[model samples]
Target chain A: MIVSLTHLDTPAALIDVPRMQRNIQRMQQRMDNLGVRLRPHIKTSKCLPTVRAQIDAGAQGVTVSTLKEAEHCFAAGIRDIFYAVAMAPGKLPQALALLREGCQLSILTDSLAGAQAIVDFGQQHDTNFDVWVEIDCDGHRSGLKEDDKALVQIARLLTRGGSSLCGVMTHAGSSYELDNQPALQALAEQERRVCVSAAQRIREAGLVCPQVSIGSTPTALSAQNLDGVTEVRAGVYVFFDLVMHNVGVCRRDELALSVLTTIIGHQPDKGWIITDAGWMAMSRDRGTQRQHRDYGYGQVCTEHGDWLEDLRFGAANQEHGIITLQNPASLDIVVRFPVGSRLRILPNHACATGAQFPHYHACEATGEVHIWSRLHGW
Target chain B: MIVSLTHLDTPAALIDVPRMQRNIQRMQQRMDNLGVRLRPHIKTSKCLPTVRAQIDAGAQGVTVSTLKEAEHCFAAGIRDIFYAVAMAPGKLPQALALLREGCQLSILTDSLAGAQAIVDFGQQHDTNFDVWVEIDCDGHRSGLKEDDKALVQIARLLTRGGSSLCGVMTHAGSSYELDNQPALQALAEQERRVCVSAAQRIREAGLVCPQVSIGSTPTALSAQNLDGVTEVRAGVYVFFDLVMHNVGVCRRDELALSVLTTIIGHQPDKGWIITDAGWMAMSRDRGTQRQHRDYGYGQVCTEHGDWLEDLRFGAANQEHGIITLQNPASLDIVVRFPVGSRLRILPNHACATGAQFPHYHACEATGEVHIWSRLHGW
Candidate 1:
């Protein structure tokens, strides 16, 4: 007795297509107003349809974190791609294939050894490759210091060795750790300074560094200036989560994706309601750790996607989540939900949880349902 | 220039088949020595070859965490299964299908509400089901208090209802938090006390408590007594990891599975080497936080499966990992590995990381490699 749309299985991934389209348009409009190219990172939503929607919304190119992602997008006829992560020599064959296929492929590296390896591979294969030096903007992850002399040396080596230098790129990953818009803005400015400084150093070394890229969803959404950045790459903004909301990047209403789950049981005495959505569905992303909010797994939502007042996923295991009502005793509502009641759970990090599933049940603005396949594995 | 094995691809998954086979046999011998039925949990490997090996090693039953796993095993001719996770009403259809197909399915539940839901569903579908009342052994996750009167009441309900009460089950999930064998033994004692106590209570109530089940790799391997217990379920021992080693369950030598990665680039001056395995290849599971072994992501290994002394993954993103040498000043070896140099990474938790991949490259005891398909989706 499966209802057509109301009663699907619990702990399933659902995408609101209209909300996704709106998210894409909103991001594109922001980039346009700031006079920067939008290269939506595909790591957020690995679905081809979502990527296509980004392209359709006026993205000049797209960014990917893996060769598998680049290959998938390139095969799908996306002409330009930035393999934003540092590329290894073993990926040379795949990178060369994308280049041979007339796709504008750009890769990143932060070390001289990496540059030399790429130079040797390019020389051996008799094919030129575009390269970007990754600069550390805020010391969050991998990158070369903007003022590091080694970077200029590596840029000189690549340029002189026939490798096409494609300028510099930096991500303010630390922006995610900021508490407010001012801190995020400061990080954004720091990101611009580092990337612009690195690019200027490369240009001063008698090389053309034309493309400067800086990105972070927080920075991209609120940064006042993109005066030096040519392109921005941010992924999480398209499907904002509770983490994003806590960080003040977007409001709760702006979230476009959630795990649709069912209320299976209730402990009326303890006011504990169990849902089918668990760590396997919502992911083990404790993204709100730095913030004041300890959203156990996620924030519970009403059937129509509104946030349920003061409800939380208090505890979760691999496949079972326990919801403890914040004020269990005071609620006047029917304490027990029926066995088949459906609810949506807003995730803490959309990318991690969404990656766990194969396909998304796309709900249209008119309430039509369609299936969108997501790419998985390496 | 794709080499048949070595240069096939960078950052690929690798299985030490001989080692895994030995691991399987070792666990089986332990179970046999204890005179307990072994129900190997398939959630760790999720590969059919590994599951087949467990069957070959004398496992009478298998434990599964998801319905997808149950479906896969049932199709593969696995007759006896313990859907170890608490059952939800939404999972009724698949559970009923498996039962109808003659697969012996026993589910675990902690509360009377959950049991009653299953009984109602079974009665409505005209199907009989088996159930195990879950007991809280160590307050690690979901379960009923050992001395709760409700346990006896639920046992009575299941006995009189259409469902058959098989016995009582408990998992010492807190055992993983232990740092030594003595601590693990203490947790095991806690596990035994709760399970034995619950079984005794049920028996005193005139219910036939035929089986007492206890699980978790640490407790399963270290338990001194199974006076009232009939079965043991442990998953991670098949692919022992850094976390397991740190927790004194198994040593590094016993680890059987690893992610095969390639050297993609290097930052010689910064002492940073980049590999293809990131959080995607390895998961974000930093198991047992008190271990103090800052396995940045995972331990680095040579192509032949030996630990690369002084090399460890220091940082990771979604698809890129940065490896740092313990001593950066030493230039005794070439500062940079060539692109395509293969490496292997030991995972922190086998179950979580293994689930991300769609298939395993099954390596046999004789060093034969074959592709094993994985089960995905709902």
Candidate 2:
């Protein structure tokens, strides 16, 4: 049943279908121009409909952060999938199940021990697995260095154990911290150079390495050239948020995801409008706190998606969001956002905020709303 | 079917059942001594099994932050429920449905506009509703000030419209900021005093107001006297977190909730152990940041629940948590927490962390694990 926005419940995740489509097109077009396959990260949405939209908009495959997402996407008929996180040994069984069920799933590993575990499991099961060597480009979080001898060591271990070395993938997650274009571009280049170099090192070592994947939203959008990179993976760009806005990747108007809430009360003395969308709805991701612009919890927007510049969601409780006006006592707080009036709050991190809900209320420009179920937990 | 903790999936919410029951018993005993009913807030653990334990431990009723929680608890055979947050007009129908179903749900409102809406809706449907007035005791988030003239007006509106003026409830949520006993005791008294004053004012206006509830984990544990208060509500105390640890409410050992994660990889140079539990598992609630001690993401613990003080979750990405050694370069990071090993991380906020997962792996001292489902979304 298609419902209108007004009829849907408050504190709901609303995806502006047009805006999401536009975001998908923008990223897909950029990847095409860069001569690389776009592996849209489904972790940002974790919804099959959203992934289908990305694939429908020219994405080559889906990237996942968890095995559950891999299972969800693979069951939904997505042939190509990459379980992006460094594979845990205990999770090998789940991955093996997915592969055995006809999923062209690729697992990642940054260390020799991890690769050895994968190879051992594969050899024991008599099934050669497709594995990707993760490279650390910006000293970000996980992955091995481009010059780390372990890269080729891991690749050799996989090949020696009858497993196929699919490629090397690196995420310049630190790109989220860069607001300037030069830094983003430099990091993007660094990400590409490192992964491509890792792939080269493996091939030079008499090992077959077929792909070089690199990206993060900022790096993907700012990369001048891909060169040897085969595919690019990026999440959060599909639903740009306050953090991405502060990072200078997308305009606030381009934010596709928002939490639809209703003003339940007002602390007029403090210029605070208490809404139903708290940290639980907006998420506790104070991602924009250290960014160029700090949106307390989120930026307050009108129900029609217009920005409310002076009003900000400064504090949040479990189910109560305290929206403070820039100029306290300047406006009639109660008169402006009276009780029962609905409002939209653009979250700090789209990925974090989207994960809070079980499903998304895809709101169309024509006032139609459709529920899209999201995959929860690992 | 009972499972073992070691066999469950990584990044799972693990509730130490014995510790939880102990926490419940402590709170229930304290409320009993204070000569008041304890209405344990179900928002912390939105699971029937958890709530059942609370009810079994002498909790008279349950307090809820969302209508969904109210419905869930009511369906689970809970009759007395206080929908604590100020009633959103859009949610009145849901509340009415619960009331019609004999849930004995009490709704709260702080504004005259909200009270009038409730009265209007009640009259329109010819159904008298039990309403509670929310009093602002500490200028924390929501509710009308105890001295505000609107308090009596709202109470009058409820009574005149044939709705039962149940009582006044106030949460000294700001008490979370207090770490010392003196301050916590004072705030507890202040919360009780103001709420009692509001109840008295309502009665002076010739209205029947019986209940007076006030609490925060810190304040509830430190309260010297209940005075005129009839019942109290506190949620996070059930599954004490790092925030409660800093609040001086519960010891680290008493923390019942934790995220069971597996070591996936390591960055030896940086002395970082990459774990599968990231902010997505621990949540982004930096609630202890401004407190006495700031646990970066959480305090790392052994699978047996022993605190690893030398290690800390210094950083987190989407699905990767970087655990850094307190004395970096001292011990061998890889040797200490090798790839595929398991660890438990106590979260900053139990409510926020528990909300991240679909179910909790209730771990027993004897190595038994029971899956307790969680209610998600509004």
Query: What is candidate 2's lDDT per residue for A58-136, written digit by digit as tens?
Result: 9998999999999888888998999999999999999899989999999999998899899999988988889998999
- What clash count does candidate 1 reach? 3
**Whole-model Cα lDDT per candidate?**
0.81, 0.91
Over the stretch B98-145, how does candidate 1's per-residue lDDT look in tens digits?
889889988877777778888888888888789998887886666778
**Deviation from native of the Cα of residue A349 in model 1, angstroms:** 1.8
Error of 1 at B348 (Å): 1.7
Q: What RMSD value applies to candidate 1?
A: 3.1
DockQ of candidate 1 is 0.46
- Interface root-mean-square deviation for each candidate? 2.8, 0.7
lDDT tens digits by residue: candidate 2, B1-378: 587776788989999999999999999999999999999998999999999999999999999989999999888889999999999998899999999999999999999889999999999999999999999999999998888999999999899998998999999999888888999999999999999999998889888898898888889999999999999999998999998988899987799999999999988988889999998998888888898888999989998789998887889988999998877678777887888999999999999999999999888777788998999998
Model 2 lDDT at residue B39 = 95
Index of the highest-DockQ prediction: 2
